[model samples]
Target: MAKVEKVKKKIADIFDLPHDTVLGLPRVTLIGSHQLYIENHTGINLYEKNQIRVGVHKGEIQIDGEDLQLRTVYSDDIFIEGKIFNIFLKEQV
Candidate 1:
């Protein structure tokens, strides 16, 4: 890891804070098989009925589903609804 990130991890561990939250990483929450909530997202790269790509700190998030709809979107949070089947992360170039 980068020096800054290594230090950040150390700090988070020492303080007992959530590493992702303290280091400003994306937080994804899945509800059953139908909904998703993302926090600390930068923006959406692509949106479609079956897929979504969201920009995050060092990469992007990919969501695969059916009849996908953005239930809520904000500067740092997003809510998606559908028959969510898969979610993955992709490194940005």
Candidate 2:
């Protein structure tokens, strides 16, 4: 990690704060197989009925599913509804 990230991690550990909140990392939440919520997203890179790619701090989040629909989108978050099959992170190069 970088020096600043190391410091932020230390602060988060000391204060018992969520690492995602402290370090600007992505926070992903899922509800069953029908809904997904992502926080700290920078933007949406791709949107399709079967896939979605969301930009984050140092990478992107890829969601693969069926009948995917973006239910809501905000500056830093997104809500998706679908029959989700897979989710993964792709680091930037």
Candidate 3:
């Protein structure tokens, strides 16, 4: 078997240490709801450590995380926030 190399996507590498590269991933700031079509997104920091407001309005998806050191958003439909130590998941009912 050939050794496979893990090629981190251009976008996924931006949030890593030493922000010297512009990977595909970018800091998104959405005013209203926007239909997102993402395949392999590395990290998403909605806002600073302020607050996040996400919802579906008029057939649009909105994500808002303000004043917080936000992190990864997985393809499995999960939200990641806070430092790894003080992280928790909340069920959106």
Among these predictions, the greatest lDDT belongs to 2
Clashes of 1: 0
**Highest TM-score model number:** 2
* Tens-digit lDDT string for candidate 2 (1-93): 789999999999999999998999999999999999999999999999999999999999999999999999999899999999999999988
lDDT for model 1: 0.93
- In candidate 2 the C-alpha lDDT for residue 77 amounts to 92
Deviating ranges (above 4 Å) for candidate 3: 1-46, 56-67, 83-93
The Cα local distance difference test for each model comes to 0.93, 0.96, 0.32
lDDT by residue for model 3 (1-38), tens: 11221244333455464222322222333223322223
Among all windows of ten consecutive residues in candidate 3, which has the lowest summed lDDT?
Answer: 53-62
lDDT of 3 at 44: 40
Segments of candidate 2 deviating more than 4 angstroms? none
**What would the per-residue lDDT of candidate 1 be over residues 4-66, giving only the tens digit for each residue?**
998999999999999768898999999899989999999999999999999999999999999
What ranking of all candidate models by lDDT puts the best one first? 2, 1, 3
Candidate 1 residue pairs in backbone clash: none
Error of 2 at 21 (Å): 1.1
- Candidate 1 vs. true structure, TM-score: 0.92
